[model samples]
Target chain A: MALVEIKNVRKSFGALEVLKDVSLTVEEGEIVTIIGRSGSGKSTLLRCINGLEDIQDGEIRVEGQQVHGQMKKLRELRQKVGIVFQAFNLFPHLTVERNITLAPIRTGRVSKADARALAEKVLAQVGLSEKIDAYPEQLSGGQQQRVAIARCLAMSPDLMLFDEVTSALDPELVGEVLKVMEDMASRGMTMILVTHEMAFARDVATKIVFMHQGRVWEEGPPSELFSSPKTPELKSFIGSNH
Target chain B: MQNLNFQQVLRYQDEFLHGIVNTLEMTAIAAFFGLLIGVVGAVLVGSGPKPVRILVKAYIELIRNTPPLIQLFVIFFIFPSAGIRLAPFPAACVALSIYFGAYAIEIIRSGLASIPKSQVEAGECLGLTRFEVFRYVVLAPALRNIYPSITSQLILLLLGTSVASQIAAEELFHTATFVESRTFRSFEVYALISAIYVALVVASRVIFAIVGAVAFRWPVRR
Candidate 1:
């Protein structure tokens, strides 16, 4: 069975529809990068996978359990599937160490005594071990983003979703965040990212999906999709990004 | 401006000291209880059931729209007619606390609203429960965001304690009234009490500043 399955999901916001019949499947240890213009429903699809947004129709299952419905069920699904947002929404009142350990300790995944070691391990994974005591505001944008990833890593999720995690970073800072993600991908972590970094997508993505007009316009290996453009939308998108 | 004679006013130093102690005691109690109500009311307004939300909303509206003096009157005078009699001091405390509560609720509610939705969503993404999200992620920052406004409201509550004088509560203003009538040195008496009020406001500001510094020691985002 696939690690994540999104089937015919339809989501609407009042009069406007954001995602229409979006279906995709992600196997374990696969790094899938989704690229599209803004308002193409790419981000919405990522959010729905972890039950962040309620779907109007269809189903999303992570590890064979349904993603939406009861709060208890969504909480269970969220534990297995972690999402990092565009805004590194770290708790401003807490130190980086406390921010990382809060979820693990609260969910009973780790005891208070072991929380310090758990935080250190994840912070090290993001190459930010020295910033364990620093607050979110004390770090640079890239550092904060790395801390956000570390916070998610602390959960030990089976799948990670990156929703434009680097979009809010400075151009100079973007590479550090991408490097951290590349390291995670090399470790065989299953990650699905919504990003506009065409070069990084081509190099790091095991599979690249092109979404246009609320649908998957094209999807294939990075070589095939980038080398030979099938749809005009994908071709134009690639041309514009390059 | 005429003949300022503070010497006569100073003769009643004991009475003035008693009044100062009483006012501070009442203000402390009212402010503490009022803050408690404000936090609980803010939460209920944000996420409580429909009936509860409406009930809290109605309470906030009712107390906000009415005058604190009249509320005190109701508690001190009207309650006695209805078989609920409270002494002057206790009646003043009850009325002042409730009065402060009404404004505190709105102030705190605004603070809660000021927190970005992304902050709460981030907590939810971590599999924290709804209450946990509010407690761990939302509450402190929200309070921090509105720290100034709430503290100012607390100062206003302290000033509002003067209204309890109308009920013969023997707080600062009530003592001023007594001394003024006896000494007939209204100018000196009013002048001295005005300085004392200013001193009290300054003292509260220093206290709040210290509290704010301690509670929110984390660096703020630029």
Candidate 2:
């Protein structure tokens, strides 16, 4: 079984359906990039997997544990599925180290000392060790996103969800965030990304899923999907990007 | 013109001291109950189901629209027929609490509403339970954002205690009334008590400022 399985999921906001019969599987240590135009439900799908948005129908299982409807179990699943949002969402009141260590201390019941050590280790991994005491507002957009990544990594989640993580950054800052994500990819971390960075998606994605009009329009290895998309929607989407 | 007895008025200073103590005690009780009702009502109105929220809204509107003096009279006079008999001090506290609570609820509810949804979602995604999120994320930030409003409401409640005099609660204003009547020194007695009330308001503000700096240190500078 895959590490993360989203089976036959359907979601709607009032009358408009955002995801229709969406099914996908994320294998361990694989990098899956979901690409589409705006309002294509890529972010919504990521939110459902992370239990941020509840699906109207079907199940999302993180490591075989159902995430929807079971509120108590959802917290446990969320601890194992770290999600980085487009907006960094760092706790502005806390320092970067405290932001990273808060979940481990509160949820995992790790001692403050141990949590700080783990936070430092992950900060170092993201090349943000020098910013342990800085507030989120003090950091650059790229630095803030890197700190957000470290925050998720400190929880030691089995799967990481990146929802347009770099889309909010400055044009010059995008490459630094992409570098950090690529480093995580090289280290064999299973990641699901909803992104518009075509080159990074082409280079780092093990699989690329193209979504259009609230459904999976096409999906395959990045080479096949990028080079010779089967569906007209996928072709046009790739065409618009280039 | 020399018929006025300033010595007797000076000798009854103990009664004035006792009145000050009584006023402080009443204000403390009223403030406590008012804060409780404010926070609970804010939560109910802010997050309750639609029907419950409507009920809370109606309750707040009813209290806010009616005068505190009239509400005090109703609680003291009318509630006795309903088998709810409270002594003057307790009745005053109850009435003032309900009166001030209405305004505080609106202030706190606005604070709760002003909190960005993203912060709550971030807390939820961090694996914090809903209750934990309310405690650590929601309430802290909500209270921080509304500190000025909360303090202002508290100070207003403290001033509102003057209305309890009508119920014969024997707080500061009631003391002034009694002392002025007994000594026939209306102007001096009232002026002294006004100064005391002003001092009390200033003192409470200083204390709250200190508490705000300590409790909400994350947001407020030292």
Candidate 3:
């Protein structure tokens, strides 16, 4: 069984269709990078997988259990699958330590006494142990994004989703966040990433999924997708990114 | 101008003291209820079902559109005719709370609106329950965002307590009227009460600033 399975997922926004019968599977420990233009439904598809957005049609299952829109079911699914957003939406009122430990402590996954240790462990993983006492605004953009990843990592999720995480970062700041992601990939974390960084996709992605017009335009190893483009869309996409 | 005889106004020191105490007590009671109603109404208006939203909206509009004096008159005067008889003080508190709550809902709702959707989504993604998301992620920041406006409304509510005197609540304004009726020192009495109002406003602002510093101590840019 696949770690994540999205089948025939059709989502629409009122009069506009965002995702059209999108189907994909993510096996365990596979870093699947989804690259697409804005409005191509890549982000929408990722949101659907975690039940953040309801689907008009189709099924998304993780670890053999179907994702449902029920509050309890969505909470359970989210506990297993964590997502890092583009804006690094850290809780502004909370210190970094509180931001990372709020869920784990509230959900009874960790006790109050142990929450500090748990927060320390995750912050260290993202090389932000020094910022445990700082607020989100105190950190640089890259640092805040790292803290966001740490916040997700603190959940001990089986799968992590990155939704254009680096797209909002300054050019110089993007590499640090990608470095943390690279570290996660090396440690065998299953990740589905929607990103514009083709180089990072080529380096870290086990398989690349190119999306166009709300469809997977191509799916192959990075070398195949880059070296031998089968479609004009993919060809132009790769060419333009260069 | 003739000499201001503050010495004669000061002859009614006990009356002035009682007035100050009553005014403070009424403001405190009304503030507590107003804060409660404002927060709950804001949440309901923002996320409650259509019917509930409409009901809360109606309440807010009704209170906001009408003058508090009229509302107080209805609660104090009309409610008695309908078999619900509240004394002068309780009636004033209720009227003031309802009045302050309406504007507070608008102020707090704007604060809640200022919180971006992405921030709430981040909390939901972490598996925080809906209430937990509001409490931990959204509440403090939203409150902080509108702290100044809410506090200003509170000061206005404090001043609005003067309206309660019309119902014979014997708060500051009513006490002043009684003093003036007896002493005929209208200028001195009015001047003294105005100074007290200024002092009260300034003192409350200081208190709010201290509370805000402690509650929202996170290193936000604002």
Candidate 4:
């Protein structure tokens, strides 16, 4: 079964349709990259998958389970599908360790000591073990994003969503986050990334999807999509990226 | 022809002290209820549904627009005619709570609104229920941001306790009036009571400052 599936998903804000009949499937352990123009519903699609943005029609399924408006079911789905935002979104009041441990302790009902241990392990994986006691504001943007990834990882999610994760980082800081993501991708994690970094998308994604006007314009293996395009829209979008 | 008698002033010292104690008690009760009403009203007005928000706004505007003295009269004197006769202390407390609560709602609403949207979204995305979000994220930061305004309002309410005396509550200013009339030492009596009121305000300010420092240690310098 596909790890993540969006079946005829449609979303609108007031009168404007943001995502129109979008459908896709992501298999387990595959890296899927979604590339699009600024208003192409890429972020909205990611938000819909994570249950952050409610959909007006259709359904999303994660790990073969339907994701919908029910709180308990959505929370259970969220425990398996971790999402990281462009803004990092670490809790400012909590230390790095506490930020990583919050959900594991709260939702998972893990003991404080065990949660701390898991937090330390993930923090070390992200190369932020030394800054365990630091607050979000004290860390550089790259370090904060690393902590955010570690935070998601601590929940033991089966699928991870990265919505322009490197977009907010300094140019010099982008490489470290991409490197962490690359490492996660290599470890057989199913990830759907909404990104503008064409080169990274080309290199890391098993399949690349191009979105246009709230619809999937074209999708294929990265080599074919990035190099030779059958559609003029995909060709023009790639041209504009350079 | 000296009209002042020193012995009479000393003879009424016990009653004078009782009035001071009564004033402090009334102020304490009023401050407690005022803070409670203020916080709950602020939270309701700041976060509730549209109808509740409108109701809260209307209540705040109504209370703030009317004078507190008139409010005391309505509560103490006018209500009695309608068979709602509350004793002086309770009536004074209810009046002050409603009055100060309206102003506090405005102050704290501003604080609650000042918190960034991203912060709230971050908490929500982390799977925290709305109540937990308010308790841990919204209220703590909102209270910290509005601490100065709230403290000032509280001290002002303490001074406003004198208005309760007009309703025959027998607080500090009422005692001063009685003392002045009995001893014929108007200047000395008024001056002493004014000094004591200043001392009480100063003491409450110091205590509040210490509490603010301890409670909000995470946000502010120690």
lDDT of each: 0.92, 0.88, 0.92, 0.86
Order of all candidates by DockQ, from best down to worst? 3, 1, 2, 4
Scoring each candidate complex against the real one, what DockQ results? 0.75, 0.48, 0.76, 0.33
Q: Candidate 2 on B1-222: residue-level lDDT in tens? A: 456555666666888888888888887887778778888898898778999899989989899888899999999999999999999999998998888788888988888897788888887888988777777767876888899988888888888888999999978888888988898887678778888899999999999999988876553223
Instruction: Give per-model TM-scores.
Output: 0.94, 0.93, 0.97, 0.89
Candidate 1 CAPRI level: medium
Worst 10 residues of 2 chain B by lDDT: B213-222
Residues A77-180, model 2: lDDT tens digits: 88888889899888777789888888888885579769778888999999999999987878999999999999999888889999899989999999999999
CAPRI category for model 2: acceptable
Question: Across residues A1-242, which tens digit of lDDT does each residue of candidate 3 receive?
Answer: 99998899889999888888888999999999999889999999988888878989989998988886578978877887989999899998899999999999988899999999999999999999999999999999999999999999999999999999998889999989999999999999999999999999999999999999888889999989989999999999888899
Which of the two candidates, 2 or 3, achieves a greater lDDT against the reference?
Answer: 3
DockQ of prediction 3:
0.76
Off by over 4 Å in 4: B1-24, B47-50, B81-83, B219-222
Model 4 chain B — which ten-residue stretch has the worst lDDT? B213-222
True contacts kept of each: 0.79, 0.55, 0.79, 0.17
Q: Candidate 1 A-chain TM?
A: 0.98
Ranking by TM-score: 3, 1, 2, 4
Q: Tell me, what's the RMSD of every candidate?
A: 2.1, 2.6, 1.4, 3.1
